[model samples]
Target: MTTTADPPQPDDAGAPETDPPAPPAGAEDPATSFTRQRATRWLEPHLLLRMSLRAVVSAILGEYNDKRELMGEIEADGFLDLSTPDGDLWIDYVADLGDGFAATYAVATLLSRPELEVAPQGGTTHSTRQGRLLVLGGDECYPAAHVDEYENRLVGPYRAALPRKDPDAPCLQAVPGNHDWYDGLTAFMRTFCQGRWIGGWRSRQARSYFATKLSAGWWLWGVDIQFDTYLDEAQLSYFRRIAEELRPGDAVLLCTGKPSWVAATDDDVEAYATLDFFEREVIHPRHARVRLALTGDRHHYSRYGASDGAQKITAGGGGAFLSATHHLPETIHVPPPRSRARSKSRSTTYQRCDVYPEAGDSRRLSRGILRLPFATPTFAALLGGVYALLTLAVGAALRDPAHGLVEDVHAMAAALRGADVGRLAGGLADSVAAFLLCAVVIGGAVAFTRDASRRRGRITGLVHGLLHLTLLIVVIRGATWLTAGMPGTWSLALVVPLVFAVGGILAAELVALYLLVVDRLFGINSNELFAGQAIPDRRNFLRLRLQPDGTLTVYPIGVRRVPRDWDLRPGWVPGDRERFAPVDGIVAPFLIEEPIPIPRTAPGTAA
Candidate 1:
């Protein structure tokens, strides 16, 4: 287990290395250990209300999907040229974006922060600011990538949060994530491909991918990969034109919606292979090298590299649930340095931030649990065990011994003591039937809670049912053995059966609780089949500056030691759209900037 600490800096920049023999993989990164100190909160009853009005609007826009001709021809007029007034290109990159209002609202606040805002603010010593190009990594909205969802979840919140750029309006561009393709890129194109007004910003790109020209031999090459399933002859041809435009020794900054080959646990090959294909098929053919590659998905800050000094970063912290910093495969993980709070917002309870997920819910639940530091299962199981014991003691006193049910229990005691196995079955019928009650309790708990805008609830009734049966068996055998001393009739029915039944239920809950806690530490399974890592609760972004001669300096900004901006008003409609402000309060206090040095290589146009 690697504890979260200051990230390492290469002593001197050199060529990126080939995949080296990795250290043994282990669970629990530093962030996981730090989160253990989190305090318990009696959560306010969460009551999520359906936004019928938003639904009505979405229904109206559904017809637009058929009008591809009107949204305009699939534009691939590749690349936009903006002047480098200061000889530096600044772009703010965020991905896994488009949660509800609060989520986008928070990011907009970062964009609108006084420090980032163009106008000079008083009392600020440093004059560093935000980017001219706003690039989205992917996954623009949640549930399913419908047009209506984009309006309320993405366009509306961002519009309300950021003031529009004009004349020299900062350019906005995006590549779709898996969720965006859920609708076959229908909504994604309309919102982003149109290159007009979207959430008060102007889209400048013509296609899902772009080859932008930056100054001094630096270029930005972003591609769609189209879910890694849609790349075609036309896409390859588009890059061929880009390659023709490039000079020898020119370096490229690559952007994709997904991160692959960065971790040992990453089993997906589409994106990873797409990258390889691009490098061999397009980049190498042009004699250009990918200097830096950035991606979203896996919502945290992580960096890895190849044998040629090239680097890849996973900076999906835009506004999704924080991923488990602890669970990152030990292979290429980089921890960030701890920071002192300049000023912070009043701490609020931890709130789940993931609304748009690329995979199944069971995986979502597992990942969400992993992001939290607390070993909730141990404590939760303790509580369940106490409740089990108490339920037995209290339930016994409430029952009248003369009742037939109670009397049968008394007979059950006699058989149990006498080893009268045949008689015991008949006496225990009611108690055995009552075991279903344990399943019922577990099923109900699983059904009631959920996250917003995700494709499905993390926990489900059926999932709990299976879990109940498995845990019940353990309880039954354990309870049977523990109560070996049923010496009398009174002990078997009134005392023993009650204790055994309640104890068994509570014991089952304890086991379930353990699964929930461990899921965060070592995210394995989900409530749903085919789940992936538990989603994390971090909100971060990357700032990259392309140096004149192709060397790139990267500053990865992290939000805080522990997130406290989890306060959201009731209702799916974030009515407080006007209230979204800089995260955790104060200017630039929460962001930790760790500069990575890129090796300066000889500059020339490759033949």
Candidate 2:
């Protein structure tokens, strides 16, 4: 494979002085429009609650009544042909981006630079030029895809990174993740599929899904699985037409929103089944090989490679919260050895290789869950309210009609001073409504457990609920003893406030502990544990180069920590490249692991 030299361009040269024609109204704004801001706080109680509700709505209504079906009607075909003057190609692959301004801008600034000096592991440092084509695998915006959010979190930072139009500007294409679909892909289509310019990079795709002919004998297929729903007739038909152009021995790079291969290993087979069917029925028949697959829903970097040299990589670490990599399976059989899904594709074993942040760092970071009370005070406050409600319920359920607050407190204390705690619990069970409420609390905890359909998942949830329930009992009894000694109604005023403030912290801490325990013991709640942490470190992205001889070299670049401060560059324009520069100096990105080289030829096939 022969590499071509792309001479670096000077900062002041190559870019046009004026902006690309004004974007459509409500479209993405250029970088200079907004100031850089902090990353999203995923664990904020309000955000978590809102996102949970949005997810439920999306699952029930969004997936079934897909927006993609309607998009097919407006767009003629989902294809972007970029195959031109035969030569080497450089491409940038990033996913799970568009969170905080600093993290997103950091990656974008690096991408915008003419070339980077990357330090590959155990090898001499080398310089690699920026990609001419930028592929956003999925989840372009965090939380939800809305017009304003696109401008703030995503568009503004990216435009700032590469502000002006340059002669060698890259082209941008994207696939929607579940987050983007939360808004029914309205903002996503406006941002990427409208054939507008995103910063200096051109948006050429006309539909949510696109088949890009990168060059002769090489193709890049960006498919929209839309919440892992089956490929609609329109999407299937579009790809089928693209397949018609494939010649024998052609190579393909698949870009999808989710990592179906990883999902299949966890017994969620629907996504993997659909992907497999597409390969067997639509691609394999044409004798075109899917040499590589990329996805970004996980917010981490992981590669699963088969003996045949096909790689399925998850590199979602563009700018979102850092996801844990410790729980990834060491090996998985694609489609599972024994599944009911119909498929002719042979079962291939993919072994996990090169996980970023290393498993140890992931575990160390999980400890951050313990800081939940301070990090997410909103969630902590909610927990406090729940505790207060439980306390009121217990007091009401045990209240004697003839007794007042002070009298009732003293009476209950005296009556239960020597009585067994079980007897008190049994008395609460006497109130069917009260018991049901308690049961609901337990069930709610269990519901948060992943794979709730499985016994282990249910048990983990039960344990989580029981811990909270036990805390409630202790707080109630402890307050009874302490306040029984205090005189009058004053105790009531003091206790009520404490229940909301102090109790909240206790409940939140209990949840954090539960998450840490379950993640280590059962490999559950890893996402929740880290989402609570909202870590902004360990960011990464992939830069790929396709040589003239048809071989691909992947540089997995990473930043150990993102810079938090930035200074405005001198004489920067609204759409110029150097709008914001890191005040502490640019943090160099290093290769997380050794570079992976994949020849157009497979291990057992002839070139």
Candidate 3:
């Protein structure tokens, strides 16, 4: 099929600056006006200042986090067998994708890479063969999985990424992620099922889940495992038949959307159990050799191998925020693995791909020798709330000097110095009561929000309230700290930098919270936030090849940001620059896994 120059793209320039219906009029109560105003002050736009401040914030706290990129395992001493047209199957897979133009940039980079694309005269008598298959892991678009988002975010960007179609076009296939199911798979079916062309590629699978025929001995299974899923009876039957149809030496590569065993604060045992079930019932029962299982929910790369001979690979880095490897809790296996499993202690990957020159175990470990406290927003919220109390105390001292809380506190301090035990005890009781009263007032404010009963509404209220409360307190306490001693002493001068540093941290937290509410809560889809505080920022994907010799090689590709000279003018938004484009433009390369030789299976028996 001939491909044309991509048509005009969506222009969000004139579209309403605000969307998702803008919280409806009267949603913001008049009583909360003060809090909203405070929010605006800290989060108001001044791009350069925000950038400068974020640079400082990252420098201070970024080191607190590090990742193991799994590069050596993927690269494996450079024995890539990358000589294309080797009469082998080439598959490029990505998941949780379609965030912005950066994903498109990643697609473009893959298409442009020599290893992924086949050259003329290398294969086929007609000299018209491409060595790659376009596989979508899931989540085609952000916000909701709607038609407009697919066209604007996915289709348009894809067309721009690879403008010309290969004469022998690569087939497109997608496994729907949770976001895709939000709209009942309407957009996904319309785009991928109806034979509609996305750029030059087309989806060939009739159902959401599909098992494709690759080399004679290799088969690929992409299951829907729909939202919070277990494979429905029909899906199970479909796969079971595929299993029955395969020969004895056939090997399987399983692909799903969410990671199986990430020990998140809210780990989904049922979800993992579902995958585990699919393995035991759908695949293992049929006696096919299982080589690798692939998933892409968290936006980073991880590879896990077990003593049971099962390997798990996560390559969610399609185009989302980076996932923090250090913060990820231990992997929790369902049924708790009754035996002594030393899986966690034996991970063979440690090199992270982001900020390449500064990547790798030794460098990152050296940079993050000591932990940085309060790097997360939860800590910021606590500090912010404390700062508020201190400010109220100081203000009361100034406004009503004769009968002020600060005066009472100072009197108590002096009494303690003079051994006035009774007076000190009374002052402490009064202070405790006042603190309780403040908590009640803040809780009332959170409860008063109009949408407090909606999904995550109450949590949002509490988190936001605490965050704002913390924001205010930080400013107040920081000011007080900077001026604790008047001009005569050098203490104030010495404390100035610390005060500014505190201010910077608070500023960073505010910025993070604002984006969280806008991008996730009020916007469209939401990621798993820890204590609803911080959003991880890793975007990545994977490239896999099953050679004729039965060696399976995996390459986990990460897209840190958009490369220089990419045109995002197609679907421009106000915050698009900051969202998709970054100045430092630090990006990591593919974290390769060492190739594994697939073990043969006995006839009608597990491998």
- How would you encode candidate 2's per-residue C-alpha lDDT over 96-149 as one tens digit per residue? 998888788888888887798888667778678888789999999887888788
Model 3 RMSD, rounded to 1 decimal:
15.4
Q: In candidate 2, how many Å is residue 585 off?
A: 6.6
TM-score of 1: 0.58
Minimum summed lDDT over a 10-residue window in model 2 is located at: 1-10
Give the alpha carbon lDDT tens digit for every residue of 315-364 in model 3: 76665444435334334444234323332222222222222112343123
C-alpha RMSD of each candidate structure in angstroms: 16.7, 5.9, 15.4
Tens digits of lDDT, candidate 1, 347-449: 1111111222212432444533332224333434433444344333323333335567757555444333433333322222235333445545555545432
TM match of model 3 to true structure: 0.55
Off by over 4 Å in 1: 1-75, 83-86, 114-127, 263-265, 268-271, 306-308, 330-467, 472-523, 526-537, 561-593, 599-607
lDDT for residue 18 in candidate 2, whole number 0-100: 35
Error of 2 at 574 (Å): 5.9
Model 1, residue 332: C-alpha shift (Å): 5.7
List TM-score per model, in order: 0.58, 0.90, 0.55
Question: How big is the positional error of residue 555 in model 1, measured in Å on the Cα after superposition?
Answer: 1.6
